[model samples]
Target: MRAAVVGAGPAGMVAADRLASGGAEVVVLEATGAVGGRTRSVLLGPGHRLDTGASWLAGFYSEALAYCSGLAMLRRDVTGTPQLVVGGRRYPAPFEPGVLARSPLLGPTEKLRFARWVAGVLARRRRPHVGPPRRADADRADRIDADTAIREAVGAAAAEYVLRPAFETMVFADLADLSAAFVEGWIRAAFDGRYRVPAEGMDAPWRRLAARLEVRCGVEVTEVRPQGPGGGVVVEPVGTFDAAVVAVPAPVAARIVPPGVPGRPAWLGELRHAPHVLAYAARPHPDPPPASDVHPAGAGRHRVGSVALYPGGDGRVPVGMQGATVSAEGWWSDELLAAGLDDRALAAALWDEGRRLEPGLFGLEEATVLHVARHPHAVPVFGPGHLARLAAWSPCPPVALAGDWTCYPCVEGAVRSGRRAAEVLLTAGR
Candidate 1:
């Protein structure tokens, strides 16, 4: 059987990999010029690359990272000498678990309250060796909104001070719109988890995977339609295939798949996403460059969600260059993003915000490298009834869905969904 995999992101890559391994004629079509989607990495120096998207591989992504000998993944060990800049006063942010007891920033009462809330969540997620099962889905009456759940579980102060920088900025979505279950799982897994980044970068494995497959870059799939019952599927700008995987982002998938396809969701056309703006700038700075993360939430006026510094390191720097990447808190509105992408001023505004976010500890003034990217449909937003809409959504005949939007909002989810789509086609074809 022949299969067409759409959108050459993690999901599409995994789908093509699985299908090809299973003796199917697989073809991957990517709109961009390269393979990795959000795994897009840019050349930092001669032999270095920095992942501007999906930077880390969480330890719990066991199945996804199993191949390529852990995707050159390494367990990163960061020292607990953490400093948090909140306005004029910089406080100690405890990263190590037990070190929290010695934290000078969090009051005893606040720490106790936060601990209790965490304990409650961990307890809920815990599985007894041989007891009744727990439903770990993202939908719970009390977990529809992350901000409300965090505030109710711990306190408003905890949500505002703790959740804002750590979770909100990292996920690129405001806690109010994110599903609490998703956030809880993200935090719980991160704690005590062995996080890894590729020894070189996140794009290596995808590039290798694409090398063994028939991947056509710069080929935008405009439409996918069923020929009829018992007939093949047509992928515009590509040939017909027995089966296909629509692995693009939801918005793009909505546009490509024909309207009124059997089993398509009424709200499939109404999917929502938060845009993303990632900026990387280079400069020459002194020792002890800056804190790893500097969020603009409590800082002075800034439009970005958070900024993470990347100083000159092994292969990360050229001669005397240092760089920083910023993720917008909640990107410009959809209408604004669509209208403002071509606006060079918009990119300038993002770069200026990156400069403001820097602590300026080393008197780094000149930036040698400036790269700004805007993803209008960056992260999926799971709001109220989102699960219902997802459940109602279905692919057209001989076409399957893939991508993070089709499952959870992460690389692991995308990989799992892609493999599942391939399995569905394999089973049906057999």
Candidate 2:
């Protein structure tokens, strides 16, 4: 059987690999010049590299980890245990060790309150069902899942410690739009306390997956029409396939697939997209400490010693890996600038601080910065009631859907969704 996997992101790549390995002829199509979708890397210099898209991977990302391990992707510890800065005070991260070790933001009572709330949530994994208590017919027609805000569940203290920072970095939007159940699940996974990054960036693993499949880059799939007779998909530029899996982002998928297929699986219209900016810089010295020593009044704690950077020469630093959060209105640039960060200045400061965070850190020199691209809607918001929407958008035979946005918007979720889509296809003997 011939299968066409649309989109070159993690979900699409995984599905393509699985289908090919399962003895079906698979053709992977990507709109961009390269694969990896939102997890791609950009050339900073001749040999320098920066991940222009998806940056971090944690052990909590089970599906992603498994896929990477299967592909033999190497990883290094990039996780930093940092002090949380709120308002104008420094406190330990919401975790127990960080909370008890030190913090000026939380009083003893507040810390305990935060800890207690986390303990309670960690003690339970039975995700709370959202919307109408019971699943209504409309719920199945629509995607339905757990619905709760992290703030409401963790309370203000924990929310301030954990949810706030995560929401800041991940959601890059207001907490009102994020899903409580998804956030809770991640916190529980982190309770195991391990986060790591691939030594060669996320692209390495995707590249490995690509090695196992036939990927066509720069292929724009305008639309997918169901071939009248058999269970097949007519793909532009690629003719027809006995079966096809639509793995592109929601907006892209909406444009390709028709609304309802009656007898065929159809994805609901365009899922929402979030705007994001990814930029990189190279410098001659380590980035300097924030102009202010106080957490809030001075430099932002989120930057220094937090972003990922390569260690090497003349106190030069790279500013791309810091992974600063950009809000809807680009408010993050102000936060970064106030913290003494700019493309060139930030890189120089990192070099001054040393390549690493420890005392006497080494820095790079005028490392060449290649380029950066902004994914207007990179990570999808797993908002409250998203699960219901997911169910409502279920697919039919010969047509499957997969991507990070299809599940929880993360690498693991993307991989899992792809695996699930593949499983569905395989079970149906496609």
Per-model tally of clashing residue pairs? 1, 41
Q: What is the lDDT, from 0 to 100, of the residue 233 in candidate 2?
A: 82
Best by TM-score: 1
- Give the alpha carbon lDDT tens digit for every residue of 1-430 in model 2: 7888998888888888888778888889888899788888765444455667776677667667777774434343323434444553444454665645465555677667666766776775444221222332343312322223443443555555555554445555445555555555556655555555565667777888888788999899988777765758888877888878888777777778776643233434535666554344444434433311111112233433223334432112233322121122123433444565445554454334322333222234433342434565676766656655564554455778777777667777788778777777777773
Give me the runs in candidate 2 sitting further than 4 Å from their true place: 70-82, 86-91, 97-101, 126-162, 229-231, 262-267, 286-367, 388-394
lDDT of 2: 0.58
Every candidate's lDDT: 0.68, 0.58
Cα error, candidate 1, residue 206 (Å) = 1.3
Model 1 lDDT, full chain set: 0.68
Give the clash count for model 1: 1
Candidate 2, RMSD to the unseen true structure? 7.0
Candidate 2 to truth, TM: 0.74
Q: How does each model score on TM-score? A: 0.87, 0.74
